[model samples]
Target chain A: MKELQDRIRIDGQVIGTQTLKVDSFLNHQIDPAFIMRMGETLADKFTQDGVTKILTVESSGIAVAMAAGLKLGVPVVFAKKKPAVTQDSETYLADVFSFTRKEAVQISVAAKFLVKDDVILIIDDFLAHGEALNGMVSIVRQSGAKLAGAGIVIEKRFQEGGKKLRAAGIRIETLAAIEYMEPGTIRFAQN
Target chain B: MKELQDRIRIDGQVIGTQTLKVDSFLNHQIDPAFIMRMGETLADKFTQDGVTKILTVESSGIAVAMAAGLKLGVPVVFAKKKPAVTQDSETYLADVFSFTRKEAVQISVAAKFLVKDDVILIIDDFLAHGEALNGMVSIVRQSGAKLAGAGIVIEKRFQEGGKKLRAAGIRIETLAAIEYMEPGTIRFAQN
Candidate 1:
């Protein structure tokens, strides 16, 4: 977690008051081994809860979900941002509003991938408003799968998403939490 | 390779003359270890080529690209199918016609991710029409990067894409090449 926090402090960019862009190593351009360590840290927290599958949204979250999936020896199911040509119509669907993209998009996972007997751990790159995490949680609940918890690489503590999910009785673990960010200085939550 | 071939034969859905859907383990619902094996197989093929980066298109290709990046200890950069809010304007772009989706979509890589000094190895899940691979190759060429080769998980030999790329002198290694697929049977090209 220290390495991740250090990496974020050194290389992360703050676009505005809330945007903590860690794309240098976390998303856009991926450092596989370092991200894998981040995933392992998440797995260390949630692997004991009888998680059968790891879930996340497409594009960015795939890498983190993949690292956790690989480490936990579980299958990773990423909800598609849009329906594919080959995607079946019978799917558990949820609508998620993207602050960055500035629109609502439907995300889905095949019904067969999530079943009643499995326990699911949802992971993602960032949790500012928590719309993506909630969308995934909605899909997981629809499948009758147990929501083990939510894991995040970076959580913007100033946002209400993380606080809301935690208040809902869901166990959420974030590798790094950003308390505030200014032009040149960024502050993190105490361990 | 045999395991991959076996997975396709057993779980892959034949949607027509050429649409082999291996979403059960390759794309939608991913088997991490299995896909990692496929990536390792590609790393085996390109490890000696001095690849500085592993490249692919976004969505599904991220998993295979992630595996190869982890194995090769290099950064993996996936071209975005569409521009994101965080995406840079200066990019290397190419248009790709998707046979499955029945449309041409523009894909791009950030200018910083691909540079003249880098050595790139492109990898993907399927090589049916090779349009996606072609688009990626164009981006790498635009960057003036040295293209080591291309690695594919499954190549539809019946399609002309693989043939065309190979004839043009691009080094391509496919884990399993499907020669033909009927309603209930599928055959792979013998090494």
Candidate 2:
């Protein structure tokens, strides 16, 4: 966690007051050692919860999810943004209105993947409005899976997503929480 | 490689004539141990090449890329499909026409992450038409990077991608190459 916070502070570029671009390492260009370390941190945080599956959204979250999944020794199920060409089955769909994309897209997971009696932990790269997390939680509920908790690499605390999830009685763990980000300045929340 | 071939035979499902769905453990829902093994195998195959970087596309490729990156002790840089709001700098963009989606989607990678001197080994979940790999190769060429080769988890030999790349003198190593697949029947390439 300390390493993550330090790397974020040193490398994360805060853009336009809210968007933190970590493409240099976190999401796009990845530091696999750091990713592995991050996974160990997540495992240390959530492995005791008896989590059965690690769920995340498509694209950026896959790397982080895989890292955490590797450390936790669990299967990772990433919600697909694009529907599978062969998929035409009745599925659990959740519409996540992306604050960044400025549109709502339906993220789905096959019914067979998520089933009842499964404990799921959701992980992602960034948490802003929490729409994606909300979508994953909705899918978990629809599948009758237990919500173990959520782990995020970075959380925009200025945004309401992390707060809302915590308020909703969901246990949340974020490696680095951005307390403030403005022009030429950034602040991190003390653990 | 035997384990991967065995896993594919057991878990992979042929959706259509072209697509083999290994959703249970390869792409959608990932088995951590298996992914690690696959990565280790890829690393073993490419260890002599002096690979400084592991490259792949976003979404599904991130997991396998991370795994291979971990084994090789290098960073993984994924070409993003549709740059995020934070991404606006000059990038090497390619239009990948997907027969499954019937659309040519643009995928791009930042210019800074990949340098002229870097030796890159591209990794991906599957290879069918090789559009994605081709695009990555193009990106590498544009950046003046040395392309070590590509490491694919599964390659559809019936498709022209593998043949085309190998014909183009690119080193390609696939864990499992499906030479034939019929309804309830599958055949793997003899190594």
Q: List per-candidate RMSD values in Å.
A: 1.2, 1.2
DockQ values per model: 0.85, 0.87
Candidate 1, superposed: residue stretches over 4 Å from native:
none
Isolated chain A TM-score, each model? 0.97, 0.96
lDDT of each: 0.89, 0.86
After TM-score superposition, the amount by which residue A6's alpha carbon in candidate 1 deviates from its true location, in angstroms, is 1.2
TM-score of each: 0.97, 0.97
Q: B-chain TM-score, every candidate?
A: 0.97, 0.97
- Docking tier of model 1: it is high
DockQ of 2: 0.87
Candidate 1: chain B TM-score against the reference chain B: 0.97
Tens-place lDDT digits, model 1, residues B33-62 = 998898988988998999999998888888
